[model samples]
Target: MGSSGRRQSRRAVVVATVTPLASILGSGLLIIVPVLERTLGALAVFGAVAICAVAWLIGTVIRHNVLVVEPLKGAGSLDRATLLLGRIADATIVVAYIISVALYLRIMAQYLVRFFASSAPDFLEPLIACVAVALIVALGILRGFRGLERLDRVSVVAVLLLTFVLGAVLLFHDGSSLVGGDLTMPPVPRMNPLEILLVLGGIVITVQGFETVRYLGDQYDAVARVRASRVAQIISAFIYIGFVAVATPVMGLGTPAGADSTLLDITTRIAPWLALPLVLSAVLSQFSAAIADTAAADGNLRGLSRWFHGPRPYLISGAAAIAIAATVPTFTIVAVASRAFAAYYAIEAVIAMRTSNGFARKSFYAVLALLLVAIALFALPAS
Candidate 1:
């Protein structure tokens, strides 16, 4: 490739790699923020960002160490414990994806009912999103990461643009609110250490997409993958911080019609003209994210079993996702998913430390400590 060609290729790789990560992270914020609010109030934004930074470090190390060129296998130590733990970690990730899709379906359904078609039944959004996801997976419409990434490039850009517009309007309307705001770290209350710990543990799920870097083993060199993953994490952090900073303060200004309607709530409060567009963007972004996640879950399923390594695995998995989405409430599944993911992170920390050496191993040890603290918090009673 020529210099121009090289640059274009690089941009595509970055976009392809980063956009799905961005989509997944953007969709996750709605669920993550509320969990944070229970413990840190507005400071949850900063806490979440801090966790992202550490997650980025830990994820990059794992990605570097666990390169998987083949879709069905990973490169790592061959001990039975390592292999068993690796399967558990991968299975845990698959479970997270499934639960997230169910939550997305419920949220999407609510958005459609409230904004787009008041007469539409509450079940419409999940039905449509589930069918779309099923068709895409079953038909193999998305060829691989590259295809999904192409779709995500558009989805992520639309999501970020609308989010920027919303944040800008919110900030302009309430610049004073933020100015007088003391964003200093608040002391954790002494009375409910257990309750506080669970919230802290849940915050770990906010940085869920960083591990996605491992899938790039086939398409990019190690250096390229590292740079791309780091860039994606930084972008996601700013996006999360920007939204939380603006949205959390403005939340009290207007009541969202429903729990899942934060984006619509803020946009309607500060810039009514932007609400529809924001809603549209959010729906599309989330739908795209659902597709990406469903695809990923199917891929992981195939990786885990030879019977699943066929044309119908996506169909089977996608149907299961739809079934789960159709039956469950949003937050209930979200809470379950968050706890499951926290467990995954805890296991992942052990795996990374066990398989690593030198500085990487030390870093995993530090992260392992953090994960343990977070997990212990979850074991405590609600404050």
Candidate 2:
């Protein structure tokens, strides 16, 4: 490849590798976070998100660029801090993904309840949520990373702006509501640390795409890519925190909130104008996330086929999408997706611990242990 060719290839690779991570994070920052702050209390949400941000910048972004590559000859650790910070991002994302899903369980339960109570549940729209999850997973299998990253450039911004506008409108109309509440919030023992760990396990799905950089290998300007990814991850973390920070107070007027009463719930009650559009946007977020997933799955499968020197990757990969769609019933898909995500993150954290630098392995293990405990606690009990 010529110099121009190499640069173009590199850009394409990075974008593909990074996009799904961005999309997932963007969705979290927007639609789900308002409730995160409102119900949890701004300070608790802020604190956890802040810790998450720092954890990600240090762990995943730095790890791959520096530590993962360093096992090869001639690559220096991104600096002395390489091993320590790198593991933090890995654990943070692993934990975050898990928690995101655990939180979603409440919403899924509500929808199921509603469906049961409704007279014409059979007439319900085909499971858009299921379609969304299968599409996302298939995208991961198909698109490699580049496809997802491209989707994120726009999808992330769209979700963010839409969410911000909806949130801002609520604050503008109901400024006084925010001040009337007690700053302190009683904790949901259900969402205690162990459960929180399980919930964050789904958040692991958000950071899944960053692993794409491993394929970039010798082509990347290692230090620079690490820096860029870390910056992106940190900025995303703070933005998520800030969003819930603003949203919770704006929605504080309602009956005490539950997991179902998150940012979207509060908005629907307080600002119908915002709610109507936002509900649509939430669907868009779901759809967009699914599209990106399909794209990623397609690319990955194609690459694997090539790596194994197999024939006609396109056919097999294309079929993979169809297969996912066919096998996973569209209606229960979101719960399935969330559950799958929880499982995936739990596994990833364990892998991260095994792969992390010495001291940081402890951090990864701590989170990993908590997730296992949560599964036994919440899921096993319910079953």
| Best prediction by TM-score | 1
| Candidate 1 lDDT by residue in tens digits, 115-231 | 767578667866766765566565564464454556666777787777777778767766765576842323333435556655555545556666666665666665566667777
Model 1 TM-score, all chains together: 0.78
> What TM-score, over all chains together, does every model reach?
0.78, 0.58
- RMSD in Å for all candidates: 4.9, 8.3
lDDT scores of the candidates, listed in order: 0.62, 0.45
Residue range 132-209, candidate 2, lDDT tens digits: 344444444455446444445665566667766865675464455447554333343334655444444323333333
Clashing residue pairs in candidate 1 are 197-377, 198-377
Quote the lDDT for 241 in model 1.
74
Estimate the lDDT of model 2: 0.45
Supply candidate 2's per-residue lDDT for 9: 61
The 10 consecutive residues of candidate 2 with the worst lDDT sum are 374-383
Q: What lDDT does candidate 1 reach at residue 248? A: 60
